[model samples]
Target chain A: MWHDRAMSTTGRRVGRPRAERRPDSGLSAREELLAAAAELFTVQGYAATSTRAVAERSGMRQASMYHYFGGKEDLLAVLLEGTVRPSLDLARGLLAAEGSAEARLWQLCRSDVVLLCGGPHNLGALYLLPEVRTERFAGFARMRRELKEAYGRLLADAACCTALDAGEVAVRTDLVFGLIEGVILIHRSDPDRPVEAFAAATADAALRVAGAREEDLAEVRARAAKLAQG
Target chain B: MWHDRAMSTTGRRVGRPRAERRPDSGLSAREELLAAAAELFTVQGYAATSTRAVAERSGMRQASMYHYFGGKEDLLAVLLEGTVRPSLDLARGLLAAEGSAEARLWQLCRSDVVLLCGGPHNLGALYLLPEVRTERFAGFARMRRELKEAYGRLLADAACCTALDAGEVAVRTDLVFGLIEGVILIHRSDPDRPVEAFAAATADAALRVAGAREEDLAEVRARAAKLAQG
Candidate 1:
């Protein structure tokens, strides 16, 4: 799942399966610092969390943490790039196909829902991280901005292909994202609701609100019915 | 304008109308504490920012802050109530009237958009507060669940009144709330965007997705077009 070529650094390994299987052994200290930072920032938050805490958590000396990442903000930049860049790249590639706008959007929403929910915890931690919004984390903020733009472009393309208005596209994007967020919020509220089920419901709702044609609606109902029967 | 009850909480004055006319001295110490807590939790992740920092920022003794809020978790509860309760009450009030599903939903969405944009900064800040997800602020979490239920009931009623499918109602509510949150997020990111424009777009888009009849759509379009032209 790791995309080494995705990194522009000259010496970085590209498509090396061995490197991905044992990143702890393969990654430069900088990469390890970022992984550690992502976990800490997501769990303890950026402000209350400190470099020393990250160093201790990652089993490194505090001074080494500083050498790899100038400070907490730089670690945030690295973590955000790891989380957001590949997600957008994957979305852009998946969305670049000929299909019904409804179908294309369904595909896109599914990918996001999976990314958000297919974890021990939802990606809300990353999205809601305080550091990402602060001036000190401007690099991460820029990445977030670009990610949104990329998603918007995908939605706009779907709208054009499907004959939906620009305003409608905005509505569709908001509904899909909000539904995903809401489901994750609900899952966090009650762990009993499997994220996958909610993710499926979210994808269904997203396609339906995009004004899926009758055939598409019937297809989804059939799927839901099948799930019930099975 | 504040509700009469809210205004009365501070009381008019012990003496005469002349004294009441004098601006209430800047935020009371308690008020400053709440405000500081809200801002800190919003700007820094709740886990990252300490109650001590809030106290220091507000220039109040940390122990004194505990007197008002009890603890950091309690502070989150108060912040959410300050932001969420009024909106739920307003939504319930709007749902009480008799109208077609479209009209009723439009009213709720309109009010929600207005309320959301009314205090853009605090609204987003209060929402993405990290502590909100943890059970540490159960009261605040209950308020959110109740708010969602209130919105859900209104959507269900509209579905019954308009003859829409139950599934469609679920989808519509998700879509409507999505538009509300999305508009708020957009306006927060670009504070210069006129709140009125965002509200109108939200209302119109929601109406469209809710499957407003041609007559109702025409009415909304006319009103929206006039607003835009003006």
Candidate 2:
């Protein structure tokens, strides 16, 4: 199921040859444009960021950008895709993997935090920008909903052993997402902290939000370790 | 301390005459511009929202808006102040009022959620816009930090009796703020739910984030009730 969803959504063939893919370090014109566009969009915002500025930032001529992207909106679409696709792919993989629900959630939370914090800036913060909420970005919104639903399913599974009902599960799922995303906001305020610490703390907080009992967290942590090894 | 900070920051005299204040219904042209600007800025991105549009939306001439605000940036500053001042005042009141730290934190969380959800759009979300994070809005950022400090103080006081240490209190403070702010994001995704229900649930979830033990939650809820009555 995960493989089917990933392949369909991203249009990538299964087991594609890595040799055909370009590296992310501005080696290709397309990747260079994307890297430059992401920085500009995040710093100056979507409405204020222009394709011309993006080209200049990428050390390419303004006219060449049109060959790569049709316009500014297309650049933004690609950037949003860059942010959402990897998380969705990881979520699908984890949801399909064999492990207890608690352990799976821990893994998801940790990886998500690492992604949000490992970036040059808190790129996740880009989602909160007003421009992204408009109709043109409806696809980003849909992808976000898919990620939330993935969290919802894992949370529901984890809550099955506890006294939490369906309604509680739904509310807790949203809160847990907020807890994870909140780390990005915190990093914005204090960026000097270690990313590993934030990831570990967020995973622990996610478990608590999912209603894992204190005594049970030890076992859940052990399971997470085993899952990480696999 | 809270009172002093709030008063100095907002620059309003205590016990000011109500008659000195302009009514909020656009009865005054300045109020009209503010109302229209808030709606426009919340609906359209700030960079996309023009002062001319704000004036047209308010049924005034474009030149008339300049009498109220110098430009679009000034209009945004006013709109942001409108969002932050009321909450700062409320936080100050709650901090200065008589109650346990737990009860005050509950009141703050519940009322903040109510304010965020009660608006036609999630005005609290305006803070997340990339445009708002720039140098022009440094004052807004400082005000936001002050608000977060207010929350931190309350959480620290509440955690005094618990096993939570200084670092835990700080982490929990950020998480609780995120949980509270997340309500706005959730409401954006699912606005049909009752505002009161979201407020109640958020308040409960905040207490959980602040390290309230299950056994202690009953008393905290009772205190919240008493605080609400007063």
Candidate 3:
């Protein structure tokens, strides 16, 4: 079935590809459409991007574009989900695992930053789009909220964060989570920067924000290194 | 005198205000135009916002709107600068004043966050708008660049951060600065959030990211408190 047919850098497909005049991205049509949308939305303002433009840029017929996504909003929704789903999955696993809270938190942050900055486009930056606040994007919003709460959980449980009361924990979570999300803006300015190092530094900064002590960080770093290897 | 006119929550004005039907923002014509543009561009979006619409929303005649700003891009440029100028001014003062780097850094971070989060609208959020990357906003971009360098200088000079090499200092600066810019998004989500407490927590988190130790923070906090009152 078309739905089960795997595509690289994209999700499910619905209908047959347009046989003629498609972009030779080697990606499936759906993937090409998303790639086109990502570039247009990020480079130009989203409101200025038309479905016809996305279709044209992807080198497919406009009608065929609907086979992949309902319209511009659908394309945006998938792009957003692609950015968050990986981080959320990792966060879920980190929550269920046995490592120290500091290690797990650090791992989640490093991994999440890597995923966020890893996209072909700086998709994480799109989170600031005003259209994202609407009810239509609520699924993406819910997933992000769960991901944030997971960060809060890992942070609150960290041994180093124990001195913080509930209010302090919430505030730190806000800052740590903000730092993670915000790094994308900085990252986008210099997209060629090495991701692994950037991710590691961002995670370290996050730990500091969570009140992790310096002497304790070496142990947490070692444990987090193991988590990365595993 | 119009050029020297300093309107509250805004900046210099231009040619005579429209004789009739301007927005009762108690602001000068230029300030009113900015207020309207800030609201519409963020709520709706920049691409979707027309200069005429901003003019209409500001309660000014379309023909006379040009008497103030050159166009939509001019309106945007002013709004962007308004967000950064106060923070930049504060950073300059903090850099010149005597204190532990930790305390000055903390004070700058807190006060900057307040200015950022304290905006009539979340004007800082507009920094991500793609139009900002264009050459037209170069002045605002330069100011922001200088502001970031100020952050790096403060971070690199901190005693606790002494062990960090130059590269690590750069990375920490990115994360801390990212945390600061990124907080506007979080602050917008919970617009009712108390700014002072939020600013303090964010500043503390920023210091941690800069590698300030817990023991050092108490004195830094005291010194920062004095800076606040001074």
Candidate 4:
């Protein structure tokens, strides 16, 4: 009976047989499953990854996994929402912050870099699943549109603050984001290269283009100085 | 017997064969297959693209495609080598040209953007392909490493001409490339966006970050004036 109780329990035992687990908790089994799926999906392409693999990573039974996520697509939806929505919110907040346009824009870019790199592995398993990348994901298109508008607004604001024009802002925003994302590809291709170094270098480079003065801001200036020293 | 003779004939026959006969040289048919495959591979990814589908798109037999390129991987290699190699060589030539570092570097950047955007559809296709991206394809790693070194060298030269340090060159190079490639992604993602606008914007932004001014040279002055007027 003790063995049976221990077998069914995780961390604590409840006097129940074949229970469906707790109905509510912080990051329940379902949320955990989705998290696992997101990590796996981003690292390995979706077709290469499997539900069983996700279950293994999550330390749960395959049958129990289905009970939480239903299927791959459902799991994908949840993972996408969890991974992107938060970052999107962060971007919005940073862009909407009360500061000089350049400062707010800098914050927005920094926040995106943080969100993209702050994960189990940088950017999580989102890239692994191309299905969400395509036109099929329910809100993916809308999300992309919103993101473009937000970025555009941030650029416009930054330009206003920096005394740059719309054209200049558009170019700067495009290039900065590209370097951040583009270096991700390079880092992934060459695991030997330090992702942190690339991220720092690229981030500093981007800020320099944004007119970050070395004498004005000590922290970002220091980072840029280090990269320049390199 | 006459039909077989006509079918085996190369180039345009003296008589018409459009309605009742097929060409003998099969060169046109082969070219069509290559074009179709490149298009599909760019959009859908290599793993998802099939030989039969490529053949159908080309209006040729799948077996005939094998005769031309051996297999799909060979086809892909041809596309990469055929398309990207020439452009890369051109970029190298531009970078290596004898001039002031700033002049050569500017030429390299401008020519790179031009060569990369050589075709309307294939500009970003290489980056999109799974087989071609992330060091999966043969020669891609070596090519990428060489490209990086070349970029480093060009930046070093720029710093030397500008009397900046190695570290400064590194930072400047990162920002310059980041800005250029980043804006390229923006223009590519939205076809309606003017390419010239993107190019000028990126060039101007990079020049600004590099501390370039009208006094730099007559050419820089000319380009800057063009951009300012635009």
How do all models score by TM-score?
0.69, 0.84, 0.92, 0.71
Which stretch of 10 consecutive residues in model 4 chain A shows the poorest summed lDDT?
A13-22
What TM value does model 1 have?
A: 0.69
Clash count list over all predictions: 1, 0, 0, 5
Among residues 3 or more apart in sequence or in different chains, the pairs in candidate 4 whose N, CA or C atoms overlap within 3 Å are A41-A128, A42-A125, A42-A126, A42-A128, A228-B167
Q: What lDDT score belongs to each candidate, Candidate 1 first?
A: 0.57, 0.73, 0.85, 0.55
lDDT of 3 by residue, B54-145 (tens): 98997777766777777899999998998889989999998898878889999989988998889668887788888899999999999999
Residue-level lDDT tens digits of model 4 in B1-230: 33443333464433222222236434465567678887776556566778988977776666555545557877777676654465467558746566555555555455555545555454344443434544436675466446556656766765333667777676566556645544434544554665565555455556545645523545763643443344
Model 2 misplaced regions, further than 4 Å: A1-26, A159-161, B1-27, B159-161
Error of 1 at B160 (Å): 7.5
- Model 1 clash pairs are A48-B48
Q: Is candidate 2 or candidate 4 better by lDDT?
A: 2
lDDT of 2 by residue, A1-230 (tens): 22232243467554321221245462566677777887887677777888789988877677666656668877877677666677788889888997698898888888888877786755766665566677888888888789889999898888433677888888888878877766656776777878887687778767876766656777887898888889
Reported per model, the fraction of native interface contacts reproduced equals 0.23, 0.38, 0.85, 0.27
Interface CA RMSD of each prediction in angstroms: 4.3, 2.1, 1.0, 4.3
Estimate candidate 3's alpha-carbon lDDT, on a 0 to 1 scale.
Answer: 0.85
The residue ranges of model 4 lying beyond 4 angstroms of the native Cα positions read: A1-44, A50-64, A77-83, A120-135, A159-162, A190-200, A211-230, B1-27, B81-83, B118-136, B160-168, B171-184, B207-230
| Model 3: per-residue Cα lDDT over A1-230, one tens digit each | 32433243365444446653345556777788888999999888688899999999988778767766778999999999988899999999999999699999999999888998886788876787889999989999999999999999998899988988998899888888899888787887789999998888888888888888878888888999998788
True contacts kept of 3: 0.85
Candidate 3 pairs with clashing backbones: none
Winner by DockQ: 3
Candidate whose TM-score is highest: 3
Better of 1 and 4 by TM-score: 4
lDDT of 4 at A153: 75
Assess the local accuracy of residue A55 in candidate 4 as a C-alpha lDDT between 0 and 100. 77
